[model samples]
Target: MALPGRSVMPTLGWRWLLIFSSIPSFLLLLFYSMVPESPRYLCMRGQTSEAMDILEKMARVNRVALLPGILVSDKRIELDENSDPSEAAHLINVGDGRSTVVSELESKTGAIMALIKLLSPEMIRPTILLWLAFFGNAFSYYGIVLLTSELSRGSSKCASYPILKHSVGSSLYKDVFISSFAEVPGLLLSATIVDRLGRKFSMSAMLLVSCGFLLPLIVGQKEVVTTVLLFGARVCISGSFVVIYVYAPEVSTRFLV
Candidate 1:
């Protein structure tokens, strides 16, 4: 998306992509300024009155009003530092009537123990495979994505001579723009097919299709045919890439966390 606009701007002999990119940054800054500080932060500092005021303002903004006596003072309330941090942070409990210490040391130790457990022979194989697959996919995917423009230009076979002659010619900027626009359909296809087909099947199918498209480029072909095949390969790869992001988080174990 940023690529298309940036590429076209330069083709018009303008160098204002940097300027236009600031629009969203400025809008986010303005939006964030209107939000209030977290109420829990105020309450932690023993500013109950200020917290209540902020909560009331929130209700009003949402076109509602605070209930009477909702913010009643409790003189008998006791603050205990030893209490569970989650309980203290929220000032509420919605669990079995049990309190467990979750200090920094305990948290770190739990993570280390989980790591140790995953190192056992039975668990190690799958863990190693998962990490290797993820690492390989990420490394190759990002390398290809970042250097697609460079690869297309430097490779004598892929470069489009006529397009290179024009303003929107064979360059990283133009390739990026075209690839980004092509991603719209890729994203849509991912959304539609991902749930219907399981993650592994979808990923494998897309990867296979991408490989099929890529093989033609490697084997050698007419320039127009190669260009079209490359575009198709990009679409297949991009769709698979998006699906993997959705799949990884779902399949990751507590140890991976």
Candidate 2:
């Protein structure tokens, strides 16, 4: 997609690409201030009024009528030093004027409060698993993307491959452009079946299918076959990424008691 612009401005092309790539981050910085903070985080910080305001805003935006006193916070919080530190903080809800314990966590806010919570006994296993999943996906996805350029430079053995005969010395951009299209279908596939198959099943199935496609590449094959395998692998990997990203945020909030 960016190849055309890069090809036009040969000298400053790479610089322009780098600048263009940063536009999304700049836009996020400019507009993120208007976005409301997470209501759950606000409530945990004893800022229930602010959280309520944000929730009201959300309700209004969605045109949903909100009941009065739906999210009241009780000012009372009891601290017990002898108790586990994880149980140090308490969030009390007095919705309908009936007091109830809504949630609890470590009250002290530190730079690494989130990390501390994630590494807690309850969250540690899933946190580690999520980290490993993300690391493996990123490593494999980029490794395959980088390998596409090398594959495009067909080897002498690939001379017999009809698909590479005409475009044996194709540029890196051409191969990238072709392989990148796989992401479109990959995204569509995820969106279509993620809900039906569920996140765990969807991710596992995609990873397994992607692995199946990748395994065949170990043996020498026709360049056309290799290209097809690469495309298929990219598609499955892209789908897995969609599922994992959706799963990431849910991991933190869902496990909270």
Candidate 3:
């Protein structure tokens, strides 16, 4: 991001950084349109043949040939994890002929109903907390980046400090570029330890650490120290941000599933 900003900010201006940063995801979204829908969803929609065709296509995609007659079972069985395999109910055929489990979605009890359910007493607290977690993670992560230029330029106020005397924009990009390395370690730590600590706990720890690192900056500090602490804070926030993205979807299943 900083590299692209540094390269393009001259003509396109700083705002262009957001555009350039988003180009990859925008292109990915465009490319995603070409991808097939989940086979399970197709079966749920009662398009068993299409779902089977997709499964076959997927089997071939990874250089694995599907058996001449075998197909993916798209039937959803309502069974507890502890239930015996022989006790599986609603089993459906997945072969040349599909026994699809078509789920009839009630139109009247769809999106609006889901929204209403979300606002219900049982869900309201979790939903609001989830939003606050997302907001805090994003706020602190970007706050450091946004303040990088100003924080680094504190040297300009003191003629005696030569190490931190750089133009705000350029210094910002430089600090951001350097601080960005923190995300690599942060993400690696999250990936390696999140499972052990559990998602919620890991997120809490990250948020605490992020806030902890930011405390030094609240009181006056040298530009170098400020930049380093800001980097540490960004590191923790970035790690928590990663956890937050995965956490919402996984946790939402408690309500939706």
Question: What lDDT would each prediction earn against the true structure?
Answer: 0.62, 0.72, 0.71
RMSD of 2: 10.4
Give the TM-score comparing model 3 with the true structure, all chains together: 0.58
**Most lDDT-accurate candidate:** 2
Candidate 1 vs candidate 2, lDDT winner: 2
Clash number for candidate 2? 0
lDDT of 2: 0.72
**Candidate 1: misplaced stretches above 4 Å?**
1-102, 156-170, 219-227, 254-257
lDDT of 2 by residue, 169-252 (tens): 333445565677788799999998898999989988999999999786665566668778889999999999999999888877
Task: Give the per-residue lDDT digits (tens) of candidate 3, residues 1-257.
Answer: 35665555454445645555566667888788789978766554456788888888888886787767744455654446686334223344433322232322343458678888878898899889998898888888787777665566564332344445545665665576668668778898789768889999999998898889877665567667877887788778888999988889887778878
Off by over 4 Å in 2: 1-110, 155-171
The stretch of ten residues in a row with the least summed lDDT in candidate 1 is 161-170
- TM-score of every prediction relative to native: 0.54, 0.57, 0.58
Ranking by TM-score: 3, 2, 1
Residue pairs in clash, model 3: none
In model 2, state the lDDT of residue 100: 32
